[model samples]
Target: MPAAHAATPIVIRDIRLEGLQRIEASTLFSYLPVKRGDTFDDDKASEIIRKLYATGFFNDVKVSTEGDVLVVQVAERAAIGSIDFAGIHEFDKDALTKALNSVGLSPGRYYDKALIDKSEQELKRQYLTRGYYAAEVTTTISPLDRNRVGILFSVTEGPSAKIRQVNFIGNHVFSDGTLRDEMQESTPNWFSWYTKNDLYTKDKLTGDLENVRNYYLNRGYLEFNIESTQVQLSPDKKDMYLTLTVHEGQPYTISGIRLAGNLLDREAELNGLVKIKAGDRFSAEKLQATTKAIVDKLGEYGYAFATVNAVPQIDQEHHKVDLTLNVDPSRRVYVRRVNIEGNTKTRDEVVRREMRQLESSWFDSNRLSLSKDRINRLGYFTNVDITTVPVEGTQDQVDIDVKLEEKPTGTLSLGLGYGSGEGPIISAGISQDNVFGSGTSLALNVNTSTTYRTLTVTQVDPYFTIDGIKRITDVYYRTTEPLYYSSTTDTSFRIISMGVDTKFGIPFSEADMVYFGLGLEQDRLDIDSTTPQSYKDYVADFGRVSNEVPLTLGWSRDNRDSVLIPSRGYYLNTSAKYGTPITGTTFYKMDAQAQYYYSFARGFILGLNFQGGYGNGLDGKPFPIFENYYAGGIGSVRGYESGSLGPRDTSTGDPIGGSKMIVGNIEMTFPLPGTGYDRTLRVFSFMDGGNVWGTEGESTGANGLRYSYGLGLEWISPIGPLKISYALPLIRHANDKYQKFQFQIGTSF
Candidate 1:
């Protein structure tokens, strides 16, 4: 717009003032679009006036031009002085503010009568949503100090509506029992105490109707539809009626199935993998499976670039369907980089350590699946999704990116527990999942629990060498107050141990590994009273008496998909603890554990765990007490206290000697909270057979094989896991056994 001039040929012949009851012309014209010496048109001038009026500051605006001199006038609406509420007890101030603003009625702003007129309607709408059908609302505006206006809205919220009747208008074929099962509003059930259906919510009703539609559609009701729903409120405004209309379409069956492209000679094999079959119910899920199976089968043949599609040919007249699967095989691709993403704390080496499919490895679906499972078993990530990102300039080379969300992989725990024989127990531990920015794991533990005291620390470095060999080390100080079950008296007998171990791994196969380690151990013993004479004689006669050092060697093979839920694989770990007692005795200890898991048809997870430990004099001095084996607990042999359930001295009736303990537990895990996809809450029935006792000249007896049958519950929680189990002893071995129930943190599994 041009600037104002002394003689701009502008003049005002007449002035038409609008409803200007308060605002001045100068204040109003300051925001006007048109000024002196500016050309104006009706559309332009009207738009300017409309813009000002839309601000809610003015009720009307008027502009007149005489001889090119313009005159503008306006009437400003009163600003809201304050807001007051009454008869509204349930809703607080925040709720009122949101409710009022829905219709544009708010304080500290100009009052627009049109918005105020809609405020009552909006308030009543809010009440209806909350099941208050008969609620009434009124609004009044009053002048306040400083030319401001106050808004007072009076409301009677009335009573919350209760469901009187809920009926489905049009649902057939499926029985009321079946349909009602999908509804959240259960008429009456034994579990009503847990989930009360008496309370009616529109959201729940709508969701039920949606479920009804899905049920029909998934059962080949392609034309299934929900017609309408009506929610009726009673005159007293305390009762509700919900009526639903649904159309269940004709059911269809799979009439035929066909596969196309890139199929190997194992067409029958591919067909078997396809879950969809002729005469089966026409299900979208089955059709999707057919496509995925074709793609996956081709993947096994190195056809990574395979496309599978399931096209449905619907036979409406015959109420049947046919599935057509088409597969296209492109050039086989290989992984350029098996990379990890979204790991802020975990190191690349840690993730890489678990991958079966390495960088530059062929994209074998089997290997990729195995690798994905390996990474998941690390327990670092809550979820791990492997997707192929195409590489530029090469159709046969792709990058495998693992997208993941890390859970609490490491734990810092403090626990207090007790048993009938042992008093109170306390333990503390710290562990790092991704140590040194690599995928190594390390843990340090200290405990003064039961009759044992330990200060132990261990660490694993998966890629200690540039070529991917792993290393592990452990150093510890452990002491035990020894006892003999057969001895007439128990004495305070203890041995101290300090050891360091290191191991290296060899890649046996893509899915297999073998490892070896060298260890150095030292031991000493202090006997406050006469121990078993046999034990003292062996230590004194053989050079294996207290005080000596020994060298050790070991081997292991691990091939489990998940330590928690292994579908197929065997894990074997064994180590030899050999040496003469550092100061008091000479002894050698050996321990080994072998476990296997297999998942069969359905959700059955079969697990077999075998563990055994023993100490020997090795033609030298007797094995030290600290080097002896003691078990009988949840972690070793359940049904007895730690260090209990062993051979006792004949005179004192106290367990004595560094002997052996054997354990084997076979369990089958079943689903709990059963139908959901998530196994966050699960229950399993298991049979545990194990016992602990002293070894006699490399011989293990029946006394160390007591058995138990039990069931367990597991809950995966944010803080940690919660596990509860009850076991009944199938074989009663002794009288000092504990009650068969056990409850512990979830992560222990």
Candidate 2:
């Protein structure tokens, strides 16, 4: 209202709205405080203007009265027409627009300059989190027809800031390098490009600080504290310097361990669960573990809501701490129901059969844990979560809810690999781990290379019987070409074999299974001048073709935490096969493998594997040459050609696989740089040693084991699992064939 209008009171006959383009007259009247035949004053005019402006429909408003007729004029804010981005390589434009919408700035909504400024700051903050310290965001606004405006966010994403140096001060016990090694963030290293540990971000810095805290606390520094941290950016904004000041408190040792509270009359047994003892260094990790163990123990006895608290009694003078564990087993509850959710594709019975915990039974944490592991091992779901929900108004009953996030169980894979010896290997496979959600599996695979070609079809019924027995059937055809032959060789030697096998798996325990199978195969050899003498001798001895009826027995146990990226646990498998004399040649072969994995830290894992094989004559019949075992490959000893180890023909220099094989590997894996703790991608350093030996026929001068060490990369890519290794042979022999670089897709070691 103007001063003139404020001084006079008039009776308004009508209220008029001017400068109305898209707004309606009735809409303006609804906001008017005075109607027709009513007295109007400056107060009413001011009230009318405030209400209209509150709607955010108008940018400017003026009120006046001309001879009892109040007139209102306003300029509305322009509605957003379109939002765009330029020079935005760091983020998707659509994502940016959605982000801006969260801050009340997007198309089809009225535009506000203050909100635009806030959006710009948010955009800049996003860049900073990604190490783009020099990033700049500028907004451009242009008018459009129909009271609308177009928004363009022009961004300049500069080079990412790198951590040039990291320093720790006020440290007496540990060196700067040692502390830095414990932190995730660090200065540039050889693997920095992949790990991005050299990049500095506030979140990563916070995590690094926590890591430092845990490191000290785990080493008995009960009073350790970080005084301060400072991050400095270079003038060019391309480099960063990090400094952490810390107080290293005196170390403390455990004086005593006391157990209190309800122990269910099992104090002695509960006390046995304590991992800490007198005179041992005080460790936060051990304290937490002890508490968790107590709680888990209580849970195993139907106490689903158990609590354990450890209170430390400090004796500062003696540098000792006495720990008191307070246990509370809240309630012994029975499961009212076991509800399964998020398994849209899989049948309920499939998951139910795997569960050891049942409805209407006392809650057992051990059974629940086993159920979770069993579900995970199925590989049908990506994530599984089981939580006990207390029943409303009930103290002794709870519902067990199993939540699952399903993943695609079908895979169509195409693989391409190159080896100095194999020469362009290609393979394709299609498989469904959970076919039609029935918990069965079916697969067809074809692999071809210069040395061999194979086609196989397999089917597996995991629940062949209600007792969890498994049945597997396989039909396969394989052809092997002469290994040392050139592509130009017009005449080459080849061997073809076809077989069908059926196996039944009987579960002896949760992690162990025993398998028995029968197979029949016929091998035919086509010989040429380039064939190795061993192959010719075998053909002549077996009359160019041979049939075998083999019986196999196998045992396997797997308790790994994860099949794809195992961090802990062990796996053992052994198989033995004998050709029945009633049908074909009489021979026996056996193979065994043992693998173990241990995780030292969040992203560091150690894996060890050993494999051995043996084949010999039975009932005076020699072991068939076609059934010999070959070594020296990515899965065996790196830096050596695949299937190129062991005995070689004295004439053609071609590898004649041996009847005995041994291989071992020691590997350490860590998260790939820049990938955080994601285990899908990792880097590993490994040492491998293995050799093959002949007992009956041909032999090569290289008789000892070949050892190699190298670094490798493993990635679960869109196509499949990919592995690349750059190995250097440590002990090379005169006849050893070295392959320094090797890579394969759709395979695992």
Candidate 3:
């Protein structure tokens, strides 16, 4: 055997396109991805030939040259005759047709034998997912008239398999019920396969194994491992069992931690940053993460090149491990570059301007990290990742690379609203969540009603520091008119205020966060006496003070994923307002919402939402209008007006300040038929029951719960999420309140 030597021995002078039946020669030339007179090596020649053949316009391709002139020859492929699908018990022909078309294998298009073969294999695999392990798919191409061929897919969907048993092997610490609960498959009932309960696949088995591993790891089993998993089949080939073997190794605890090498910060001082304490579970991965954290901490002090290695000295006899973190102190690397990526629709400047951390400086690891979090808080991205790329030439330089996944941040929403007595009203709102790349949000709300026009601007930084703190700020200038049947106080008012609030988030655990903040707000309140003295005195007790200062304290704990459509978790927000004549009375308020959603294999989703609010004027100044709770709307208790279901004045019959509100909605949202796999359009049915009433000591004729039931449409669009509903009051109760068939619409920002 002789070895080939590398050389540039061929130069492509003139390129003449030879294939010309169906495809244009110009298109064929472009397929070369290289021009005439370009030199060609074996790698390049092979690549060009492979690309041209990949176009599927040719069954054969050959490249030859004459006097430095390159010639490309291609044999066009045959056209498709018909795609015949059969034995489609699980899916229709049109379904399979669309699936094939997605991969460019439709009947009207040119036929690629390789693609058809791949599709056949995929179809067989797809059947396997549905528990048809013995399903067989055979593709045969028969020539038709005019060199056309028909793709015939012959299928045999064997008997569907049911999980006869699910066993947990090598699980000694936890009960078998725990492991079984994590499994997607269970012992089959009679005809469970027909009921879509017994369908199991390999993916499910693997996922269950991972679930088991995570369960143990999160519970302090640091060295837990999945040894193996096996599936056993019964004699009938219809019943199966999944057995997973796991090795729950000795659980080791942290004996002690030793610091070695370098400490950019004080050794005794930096010790506080280590979250993993002595006697804690010895997690190898968390140890590594802790080491990286140490390095990042050092970088915060301008020690950018710090290297930290956390080594555990195992004492298997005592089931304990001693940790040693060795550090390497290198010269602080300057940030030579900072780059932004994945802003496909948004302009670069938008994100760049939002960045408090700049480029071309001694890379402050703290600032760089804060910058990443600041960008993420913009809510314009699904994900934001910041990487430090080491420069090849200099040890003192590193480039910052920012990659963002842009998400829908702006919403164009239409609002078709109805009142308890008033007719339907159409309005629109357009809002931007990420504005000027500074992580600010801007919103404009307009209603068909003559008095409701508003604009709001808000900004927030999720990472206020290198230690992962979050800061949020909002300023709103809003003006709205109260649609009062009786013209008490002229029925309208313009109120504006500039207030700043800040909160500090304390991470108690992965799933828990404790937050506290303070706000100082100065509000100007004007009481217009356009109504009779009885109406004015009933609300304010006298002439209301025009302006006042309220010191506000707030606290909240959030464990939720989607704010708009939460499936599970709890959210709690409470605040106290005090100052001046209101200081002693505790102007307290609380808001809490809980949601639970469950989805089964049949595509059924059972969900419930509960929200409650309470407020007090604290010393009976007729609780502030803004502090009062308003209910009876689409987002609240449907089949009611936006703000017409609360407490009311006796003389003027206007909704006065309510002290408390409690609302609950049980919803079942399911995908609409004929929708694509994205399932963006959904239909939901709901029963909403809630009420707004007076507090323990207030006077405004606040009463009992108003009830409603409704059907709604939810659409997930590129602009935002859209929701519209038509609700009918179940307890209109002619005795007291306002109740009418209400229609409403909304969208998420």
Q: Pick the candidate with the highest lDDT.
A: 2
- Candidate 3 residues 1-749, lDDT tens each? 11112254577778876756767787887778678667766666677678977886777787766666666777778788798878879877777777777777876678876888878877877777888777888888888776567989988888877787777777789878777755556666553433354678877667767777777865567668877777877776677777777788777788898788766558886676677878887655566677777777888766777887777777878878788888787787777777888998767866775565677666778787767765665678899988878889787888888898888888887866553333455667777776644444666655554434444444555445644455665554444445444234565443344454555665454335556666655443444645433335544543333234455555566555456655455565555555433222235566666666666523346677777777665555555554567666667877776666766655566665476788888888775533311246677888988878874543454557788887877776444466677788887653234434443334320
Worst 10 residues of 3 by lDDT: 1-10
Off by over 4 Å in 3: 1-77, 81-115, 130-146, 150-164, 181-204, 217-225, 233-240, 281-289, 302-308, 329-331, 342-345, 381-383, 404-655, 658-749
- lDDT (Cα, tens digit) per residue for candidate 1, span 151-214: 8889877776756666776677877666765666544344334344534666777788877776
Q: Rank the candidates by TM-score, best first.
A: 2, 1, 3
> What TM-score do all the candidates reach, one by one?
0.65, 0.86, 0.56
In model 2, which regions exceed 4 Å deviation? 1-77, 482-491, 520-522, 543-549, 580-586, 599-606, 617-620, 668-687, 695-736, 740-749
- Kindly give the number of clashing pairs for every candidate: 48, 3, 2
Q: Which lDDT value does model 2 have at 418?
A: 61
RMSD for each of the candidates: 8.2, 4.4, 11.5
Error of 3 at 440 (Å): 8.4
User: Clash pairs of candidate 2?
Assistant: 194-673, 195-673, 195-674
* Winner of 1 and 2 under lDDT: 2
Report the CA-based lDDT of candidate 2 relative to the real structure. Answer: 0.86
lDDT of 1: 0.67
Question: What value does the lDDT take at residue 559 in candidate 2?
Answer: 89
